[model samples]
Target chain A: MLTIKNLHASIGGKEILKGIDLSIPAGQVHAIMGPNGSGKSTLSYILSDRAGYDVTEGSVTFKGRDLLSLNTEERAAAGVFLAMQYPVEIPGVSNMVFLKTALNAIRASRGQSPLDAMQTLKLLRGKASAIGLSEDMLKRAVNVGFSGGEKKRNEILQMAVLEPSLCILDETDSGLDIDALKIVADGVNALRSPERSMLVITHYQRLLDYIKPDAVHVLAYGKIRRSGGAELAHELEEKGYTDFVNEAA
Target chain B: MTLAAFITRSRREQEDWKYTDLEALLASTNKTFNLDTGFRRYDEDGDNRAYLLFLNGVWQSARSRFGSVPSCILMGDLESGYQLTLGEQTCLVAQPIEMVFETDSNAPAEIALKLSIDIGKNGRLTLLENHLPSNTITTIETDITLQSRAKFVHGKILASGTHLALHEVRVASGGYYNNFSLLRGGHPARNEINVTLEGEEAQAALNGIMLLRGSDHADTTTRITHQAPNCASRQVYKTVLDGKARGVFQGKITVAPHAQKSDGYQMSRALLLSDQAEMDARPELEIYADDVKCSHGSAIGALDEDAMFYLRARGLNETQARALLIESFVAETLDNVQVEAWRDIFRREIGEWAQ
Candidate 1:
């Protein structure tokens, strides 16, 4: 379970997420749709403890612990996963190595032994194939020279391997083709369970068609304007964000 | 015996005087530097060669070895006329002739030497220098002449206790020069290399890696010139600075006028371990040639936090994660080294240094 209470965030002294409150319980999927400059990405970044984002006034409690006190890596170890909109390209770092490190960090935090090389390879291979990535991609440097679809698939592969309690997919549908979208959606769907939760952040209803969310929220100017079921996504797709934009203004 | 006594005796006996300031530095240190000699001596065939030896920067000409006088090899092109062989294989011939320097000393001192090389038309040569000293300084100056199509490769390895060092090299027209320097030890050291590609179709590659710890200082500076058309040059240097050690890398590539189609690339990267450790990298490119591609980049940072966390999350402690990342950074440079045995040695040294 993740809870954000009256969260206010900004970057470079400019206010972005202005007093937003949201809560999601276990076993539910939530989709946050918003137009550009609506602070949708800012909320995800703040939760992930990314740099350059100042939490002016907010309290984020994940699994009953104060999430704001933890660093980025600590947040990840506490089962907070953020699929960044633009995944960083780290040259000379292999994807397998990167994933193994992340997974082991999380596992160690839970008092589990780190997987050995063979165990890591076996574990990564299965998840990679499930997410439609070839073994060659794992050997290459992380996100270096990767295509848009391949980068998204890599993110999903990471999510699958890490198996976080709460996954935040920030703009997971951006620049992905329909096939890549289905693969990403399937990755999310496979991880769905009674003990896990997901916040699927997107601007279009197309992604909602694949991974149906239990709840949908329209974010405008740093606050959730409306909350409804899957029907809200369909209505927004048909009506566009013009009404929400005017209302928020 | 102290270094002061050793230098005084050598100066009085040998009489090969040049730099008194270096001698004064040696006298001030007054430390008895000991080295295990009696390693297998390198073989030399009957050829014109210059053999030099320095103990704590004092030339030990008495113990040095030289071959028969070098003979000029006549070829079709004057610019490329000489061939220097390390056996039957053409070693590397941008400059003709070979010079070798060795030291066996017991004092913390510095050594500096110079050599001039001339290559004829279509000639090629290779110079291989190996330094295994005990607490000494080594400096070398080399001037090279290359005729058309002359090629040279200078391979050097500093395997042990050389406190400080510098190597300056100059290249002439229609020549290709490649230099590879590997540093393994010493408290504070430097390898300075300068190359001028004075001819068309001249190419150069300067690649090096320095792994240091324990208050060590390793500095590598290279200045490459593109003097003629179609000249190309590349430099890649990587350093691992741990403990309270420091590593410095300064590389500059210059393309002169009428050197059209000249291409140059320079990259320097460093990985810092402790807060006390330091790494400085400066890569510069200056071009006067209108038609050329020149770029330089320098990066200095601690190990990637994400990568480190990723490693830790997998099961490794913070120490293991840092070690793996440092090894990866230093091993990248060894990937280009040709010999597997040498690479193995480098890896072994790096592994020990990382720990």
Candidate 2:
């Protein structure tokens, strides 16, 4: 469902993601594990088509289309979702309104009639319970004054509602307690389907306990040094990234 | 032309009083006259109170009446005197002061009107002023004094025309004052207000909305001072400028020494609709008190591209999407208006301005 060929990206004139290549088939969850400053977040941002990231070289293709040619919203409409590490807090814009707008934007792009407020609310309520978010949270502004766990839950709720073809989870496990981590992982696991693909980016093996990945890739420096099964996550947790670091050096 | 001859021969002659060297602005337009010719004065015999009305910068003597001796002094250029005196427990409502200026000739003018009011202890006064200028210059100065426990609310709405205009207001001690200004037109307009909370427990709220179009310029400046303990002040101003218009907001909040527990908050936001449109926002807070909560923020931005795309992607055109966002921006000020009818009027005016 997604392909990357020598993906080289930089931000602010500083190259972050060096020449890298990866491919993931549909119906699979690939976890990218790396220590700090290993270009984990950079890859996710580049895939999401976020501004300020200069594609120095390489190319990314999603579902046989040139993903680099699309804007952020177009990428969003094309079923590419990125669960940001830090959700932006937009004041005065209620979460329900925001979600509805996003949903309608995607739907309209596919020539579908937009849902009304009532229909949107009904759809939101069903997903809110699935993500463990209360109705009150949906009524408030988007991510304003939300706890870390609540924000992650909100992101998952958006992902579930949008039902993107490809999902990129960028450090979703960071700052989450054990309970939040499990809920987030459960949410991701529930969304897994044969037609959907996920690229889970994390720093630890804890999140893998709930949503097991089909493949694990050790990203050191800017390139992937190793690719293994789910057990590789446990191995990295126990042995640390010392071997990868030494090999990269 | 002499000032007296100008006032007698033609009210439009005052349009030639040039403040700036905008010869094109002064000569390109016709002499503007006041549109509000027929104004019914409020009778003071029954439960209804008195209202002072001005038409085309000319104060109507016949409309000026007093239910009783007011506790306040009324002083201005068009009219000057002690209009009424409020008792310690009196409450006034539905008091409307309407002024209209219209013109048909190209000339510069300066029309100044000043009104002063003093509220007794524990008294409440509500003043509503609506200014409609065709194409002239109008300046209004309002001096207000509130005694201990006195409260006042002033609502000012300016719609259409008035080449250059200014509205100045000042508040005094232990008084709770609320001011709301809605600006929708004029080539260049200014609403300058200075408020002072001179006694303990004094409070003030200043809110404004400026919706400018064409090549208009709208400025809303507010200066609030907290001189006593336990005083609070809040100011919020929002502007939406389209075409080549310009919107400016300068808000300053000052907390004096020993004014402990003072709380001041100010926020200014502007939305530029066109590439040529401009907005300038300056929010300043000067606090000498140690125990105080003060914050000020200003933001100048164009319509949110993400929001625009979201709206447009949902079948709304670019204009419709832009109008929705601009309405939401200006509606923040109207949301704070206490009166429902007044808010409705403001909403209607804003809708017209947006279109």
Candidate 3:
């Protein structure tokens, strides 16, 4: 469902993702494990079309359409979702209001009528219940004063509500405890299905324990150095990215 | 002294009125228009307790609840302005009263209005003031005094035209006073607020929001005095200027020597939506009491670009994203309204202004 060829990206005149290539077909889940500054998050940002990231040489194709040509909102409406490493705390905009606006915006882009308040609330309640989010949490400002686990769960809830075709999880397990990790992993597991693709970017193998990936790639020094099965995560966990670092060097 | 003479002397003699130039307004009032135009029609939701209408600074009509004497609260008629005096120890809960000040001329004219409100001991009242003028200069002078343990809430909306408003407030022991203003700007407007905490343990809050566009200029000047021991005051003012509009906020809080344990906080924030728009803010605190706690802050900034990007990444268009953030910025002031309908009214006004 997604393809990247020779992806060379930079920010403020310094290259981050250098000659990187990856592909995830429909119904498959791929994982990218890398050390610090390996361009893992940069790849996700490039896919979502965030500003300030200059894609010098890259071709990202989503569902046979050139993804780089679309703006951030266009990419979102075209079913590309990026779960940010740190969710922005927006005061004054309630989570429910934000979700409703986002859902309606996506729906409008697809030529669908907007949902009323009641319908929107009902949909949000169902999705929130599945992820154990309370009505009070949904009524507060979006991610304002939320715990780390709650933010990740909210991201997942948004993913469920938008029902995107491709999902990019950027460091979803970074600050989570064991329990939060399992809960988040369970939420991701429940959302996995045919015709949907996921690119899980992480620095550790802890999250891969719950949300098993069909393929794993080691990204070091701004490029993918190895591609293998899920066992590669175990190997990296045992050896620590030392071998991968040396290979890149 | 005459209004024009007072303005001229203040402009020439004092630095307090530096930003307001009333020369044009005073010059245009030389031609008198017919005063036959009565009160302008207003759409009432029928949920309000009373409607006090004024046409060009004169009382036109006063409507109250059935069998309740409107004269008990509103005094005077077209010959003079009205004085609102609440009865002693009375609580009129959940009752919304509206006061309308509207003009009938499109030409630049000057009109003066005076209002005096007295809240008896332990009394409570809610007031909504609406200013609707088209191409006219209106000066409103109001004095409000709250007796011991009394409470008063004043909500105001300014839609169009030039407004020179002055408010003087006195709070007695254990009394509470709240004043909120939403300024939807087009012409030059200035609001001056002076609050005096006279008795022990009194509380006061002053809040304002200004939305400006099209070269409109709005200024807010406030001075709060803590005259008694243990008094507290809070001030939160926000301004949003777009399309070359300019906004200014000047506020000061003073704590007297005997006003020990007094607490005062003041914050003024502005959001500039256009590169050409400008905002000026000055928050000052003067304290003679060593034990008093006084804090003041002022911030002028453009919209948060990261916030804009966050909203857009959620699939909102650029305009929609900006409007949402702007609405959120003003919601901090609007959310303090205790009455649901009043809050809705302010929200609807902001929604329309955003569009």
Best by DockQ: 3
Local error of candidate 1 at B37, Å? 22
- What is the per-candidate TM-score for chain B? 0.69, 0.78, 0.89
lDDT of 3 by residue, B1-355 (tens): 2357557665784566556555653444332333343223334554435666666667655423322434456786533656888878887655667777766754336677778889999999888898864556677778899999999998999886667788899999999999999998735777888999999999999999999987687889899999999999998998999997878898989999999999999999999999999888878888999998899888888888777777777888888888888888988887777677778888878877887
Model 3 Cα displacement at A115 (Å)? 1.1
DockQ of every candidate structure = 0.12, 0.06, 0.61
Question: What TM-score, over all chains together, does every model reach?
Answer: 0.68, 0.71, 0.92
Displacement of residue B107 (Cα, Å) in model 1 is 5.2
Q: For residues A139-240, could you state the per-residue lDDT of candidate 3 as single tens digits?
A: 999999999999999999999999999989999998999999998888888899998999999999989999999999999989999999999999999999
Which runs of model 1 end up more than 4 angstroms from their true locations?
Answer: A246-249, B1-85, B90-162, B168-177, B182-188, B196-202, B209-218, B225-231, B238-355
Real interface contacts reproduced by model 3, as a fraction: 0.58
- Ranked candidates, highest DockQ first: 3, 1, 2
Q: Could you give the CAPRI-style class of model 3?
A: medium
The candidate maximizing lDDT is 3
Candidate 2 off by > 4 Å: B1-150, B155-174, B182-186, B196-201, B209-216, B224-232, B236-355
Please rank every candidate by lDDT, starting with the best.
Answer: 3, 2, 1
DockQ-based class of model 2: incorrect
CA lDDT of each prediction against the hidden true structure: 0.71, 0.75, 0.84
Per-residue lDDT tens digits of candidate 1, residues A214-236?
99999998889999999999999
Worst 10 residues of 3 chain B by lDDT: B31-40
